[model samples]
Target: MSLEKIKTVTLADVSINNKGEYGIGASAVDYSDELYTYLRITDINDDGTLNKNDLKSVDDVDAKNYLLNENDVVFARTGNSTGKAYYYDKMDGELVYAGFLIKFSLDSSKINPKFMKYYVLSKDYKGWVNSMCTGSTRPNINAKMYGNMELILPPREQQDFLVNILGEIDNKIEINKMINKNLEKTLITIFNSWFINFENYDNSKGMKIDDSYGEIPVDWSVEMLEDYVDFVTGVEPGSKNYHEKPEPNDIPFLRVGDLGSRDNGVFIDPSLSKNKILKYDDIVLSLDATIGIVKMGLEGAYSTGMRKLVIKNDNINQPFLYCLVKSNRIQRIIETFATGTTILHAGKSIKHMNFVLSDKKTMDDFGKIGNPIISIILTNLKEIEYLTNLRDTLLPKLMSGEIDVSEVNCDLELKYNYMKYLFNQIHTPMSKSVV
Candidate 1:
C-alpha cells in the first residue's frame, strides 16, 4: 500500500465545528475547596492521557467555556506544547480547558480518534508541528495552522482495526493504572489506620495516645520508625563528575526529579556506570524539592542526591516498605518533619519518627495481599514497556511500508483479557470512583 493511498487528513476534516475564533479569555476567580476539572499542559501525560490531579476550578464563567467531555480530544494549540494532544476519559462534571488548549471532536467514520491521537502524539508529527509553530516570545500554533496540518488515514475498517488493537493495549494500560491507584490508596489507608491514627491498644511505652479518631484494631502496636527501618541521605555527585555519555547497556542513573507515579518507582537512565549503583530493592525517596515521594530501584545505579532508605531487616518486604513510605500517612509525617524556606526539606534524622507496627503474621498477610497485586502491576508495567518497544519498532517500518499492516494480526482480545484479569484482581468490588 502506498503512503499516498492513506490520504492526508487534518483536524478540520474530522471535527464537526471548527470554530477557530473561540478563545478562553483571562478571567480572575476565587479558588475554592470544590475542585473543578481543569486541563493544563501538565495534565497531558507523555503517554497521551490526562492526569486528574492537574484539575483546578475557578468561580468564573469564562473559565467554564473550555469544558470537556469523556471523548473530547484536547489539542495544546499554543505554548511549549503547541501540537500535543490528549483524550479525556472517565472525567466527571464540567472540565474547562486552559487558554492554551483547543477543543475538537473526532469524526469516527473517516478517522478513529485514538489513531489520530496516536498520530498527533508521534515524534515525527510533533517535530513537524514544532517546526511550523510561530511566535517569538511564546511559541504558539493557531487553529488555522492546526487545520492545515496533514494526517495519514487508512480505510475506516483498517482504521478501526488498528484503533481496536491499540485501544486494547491502552485499555489494559488504564486498567493497570487503576489497580496501581487502588493499591496505593489501600496502602495509604492501611498506613493511616495503623500509623497516623494509631489504631489498636496500649501506648504506655513512653509514647502519647490518641483514640479520638475511631475504633482500634486488635494486635497492633505503636513504636518509633527508627525501630523498623534505617534512613540514609543520598550524596550528591557534582554535575562535573557526572558523565553524559555511556554504552547503550550501561546502568540507568535515576535522579530525584525523574520519579514518576506511573511505575511506582524510578526508571534508571542507561547512561551511568555500574560502579555508581544503588543496590537492588533499595527504596528511592525523593527528599529534595518533592519530599516523601518513594520508589524502589530495580537493579541499577542511581544518583546520590535522591535519598535511599535501606530496609534494615531481611524479613521486611521491601516492596511493601516502599509502598508504605510513599503512602499519604508517611508523606504527612515527612511533611511535618520537613524544615526549610522555599523548598520543603525532609530532615536527615528520620530515625526519630514513629509508626504503629503490626505483628509479623499481619505484616506477612498484608504482604501476601499486596504481592499478587504488585506482581500484576509489575507485569502490566513490563507489558507496557514491551508494547512501547514494539510500537517504536513497528512505527517506522509500517510508515515506510517495510512491514505491511495486512500481515500483522490485530486480534487484541486475548491480550486484552490477560491484561484485564490483572486489573480485575485489584479492582474487585470496584467503586465508581475514578482513580
Candidate 2:
C-alpha cells in the first residue's frame, strides 16, 4: 500500500456531470410487469443495497427517462436517509428511480464507478456525510452538493482489483441470501402442512375438530400464546451508547429495520442490557412500526420495538413457534394490534393471541422435520452475515490502500466453487431435494 497510489478527486471528477441528474417525480403504481420498477428512497437499505421485498413499478410514460443503468449509482438526497444510495444491478430488472434520488453516472474513463458504491458504504464516506449535513433539521444533500463531495481513491488498476474482490464477496452474499429465502419459504410450507393444516403426515388425516381458531386435528388444541411463551421485549441502551464499529463487548443492536440483516450499522455494549440476549434461530418479531416481520438470526441486543418469543415450556417446540409466528394468521393479528401515525407500536397483543399446539408426538415429529430446515436457513443467514462483515471490514482498508487485495483469487469459477463448498457443508438429504 502506497500513499502515492491514492488520489483525491471530487465526485464530479469521475462522474458525467457536476450536478447529478434528478429522478422521476412519479408515484408508485401497482407493480406492472411491463413497466419499470419504481425505486424510492425507502427502497434503499442502510447498507446501500436495494430492498426487494416491496418492489413497485412506475407507470408513467416518461418512466424510461428515469431508468437506471449498470453504471449509474443513485443517492437519497433528503431527510433521515440523506446520503443513502443504491447501485443499479441488472438482476433487479429495469428500474426507474424516484425524484428524491440523484443519479450519478460514472465516467468510466476516469475511474471505476463501482468503486464509489463501496466507498459510500465505508465509514469514511459516511463520516463525511455526517460532517456535511450536521445541524440540519431536515438533512438533505442536493445533486450539486453530492457532486462537490470529495473522494480519495486508489489508482485505476488498484480500483479494478478492489472492485473484483468486493464484487465477489457481494455476489456470494446474494447467493446465500437467495438460499435462505428459498429455505425459509420451504420450511413455512412444511410447517403449514405438518402442523397448521395437518395434511402431510399419516396422522394428519386422523379425527378433526372445529374450534375458535379453525378446524384442526382432534388432539391439537389452542392455548393462550402468553401461557407457553415468555414474551421478552428487547432492551434499548441509549443512543449515547450506540457505536458503529464493533468493539469488545459490543453486539449488534437489532432494530425493526435490522430484521433483514445482522449488520444494523450500529452496536451496543451487551453488558448494558439486563434483558434476554438473543440466541441463534431465536423466534423474534417486530412489535413496532412495520410490524410482524418475523426473523431468526443475530445473537445480539435488540431494540424496544422487537419481542423475543422465549419458550418457557419445552413441549411447545421452538420450530413450531417459529412457523406459527411466521404464519399469515399470526402476521395479520399482529398487524391489527399495531397503532400509531408514522410509527406503529404493537401492545401486548400476545395476551390476546392463541398458540395452536398439536399432540406431543405430532409436535415432536414436526420439530424433527422442521428443525433441520430452520438450521439450514440459519446457517445460510449466519454465512451471509459472516461474508458481509468480511467485505465491510475489507472495504475501508482496501479503499484507503492500507491493504492490497490485488493478489486475491477472485475469479468467477473459483468464487462459484467456494460458494458451492459452503452450501455443501451443512446441507442435509432433505434440504437437497427441498432446495
Candidate 3:
C-alpha cells in the first residue's frame, strides 16, 4: 500500500447528502426523566469521546427532527471547541444533538466514519481549524468550510483494519473504566456498611443509644471535622496572569471541573502564586457549584473551589478519611451547609459540622483492609491513563499512515504486557500510612 496510491477527497464527496445536507441541531432543553438524550458541544470531550454522564435530555417530540443515527458524525461549530467532533454510534435510546453541533451524514462505503472521526480529532484538524476559523471574540467554522476540508482515503479494507485496531483499544479502555467504577462502588459500599451503618463490624443487636444526630456506635465519639483534619483552600490567579500553555516546571492546576475524570487536567505555571499544592493520594474536596465532590488523583496546585484535607492525627487513616468525606451522608451534610445560589460551601459551617470519629485502632485496622483495595483502584487508574495515552498517540499516526498496523504488533496480550511494564515503572507509590 503506497501513500501515492491512496485517494484524497473533500468531505463533500463522501457524504451521501447533497453539499448543504449537513444540519445544525436543535437547542438543548432541560433534562426530563423520560426524554431523548441531548448532546451539546460541551458533551463531546476534547478527545473525541462522548461525556456520557453529563448528558441533558429533551422531549422526543422536540428532538424528532434532530434524532441521531449510527455513522453520523457531529462537529462543534463554534467557540473554543470549534473543531471537536464525536462519532455517534447506535444507542438503545433516541439521541438528539444540540444547536452548537453540526451533523455530518456520511456515505460509509467511500469513507469509514470511525476513521474520519479520528482524523477530525487529530492535531492536523486543529491546525486546519486555527487557519480557517474566524472571529473576534470566539472562533467559528461553518458547514461550507467543513465540507471543503479534505481527507485521505485508503482502500476500504485498510480503513476497516485501522478502525478495528483502534476500536479494540477503545473498547479495552472503556472496560477498564467500568472495572474502576465498580471497584470504587464496592469500596464505598463496604465503608458505608462498616462505619456508617455499623452493620458489617457488629450487630450491636441489643445495645442502642440516642444521640443528637441519630443512633450511636457506643464506642465511637462525634467531633468537629476540624478536629480530625486540617484543610487549606487554593487561590485562583486571574485569567490575565494564568498560563494556559505550561512550560517546564509547570504544575497541573486542579479545579472542581477536573474532578469529573481521573486524567482530564491541565498544567499551569507553578511560580505564579502561594497557593497550596497537592500530591498524589492527597484528599481534595470540591467546595463550589457541586459541593463535597472528592478526588485524590494528580499532583498540582488546586483551584479556589477545592480544598486539600490533611488528617490531623496520624492514626486517623487518610484512605478511610477519604471514604468518610465522600460518603453520601457526609456529602448531604455538606450540602446542608452550602449557601448562596451559586453553590458556595461555607468554611465556618464545615469547621463546625459534627463528624463521627472512630477509635484510632479501629480506623487503623480498617485502613489495613481498605488501603489494599484503594491501591488496586489506583493501579487500575494508572493502567487506564496509559491505555488512553497509547490510543491517542496511535490514532493520528494510524490515520495519517505514519505508522502501518502491519508493522505494529496489535496482539492484545503483547500490548497489555508492554503497558503493564510501563505502568509499573512510572506509577507513583501509594502512601503506606495516613497522610
Using TM-score as the measure, what is the rank order of every candidate, best first?
2, 3, 1
CA lDDT of 419 in candidate 1?
38
Per-residue alpha-carbon lDDT of candidate 2 for residues 301-362, written as tens digits (9 for 90 to 100): 77888888888977778788888887888777787777788998876567668867777887
Q: Give Cα-based local distance difference scores for all models.
A: 0.58, 0.77, 0.70
Per-residue lDDT of candidate 3, residues 334-387 (tens digit): 777778885676555575566667666768878887788778766766666666
lDDT of 1: 0.58
Best by lDDT: 2
> Which prediction has more favorable TM-score, 1 or 3?
3
Model 2: residues with Cα > 4 Å off, grouped in runs: 17-19, 201-209, 240-252, 260-271, 405-435
Q: Per-prediction TM-score, please?
A: 0.74, 0.87, 0.82
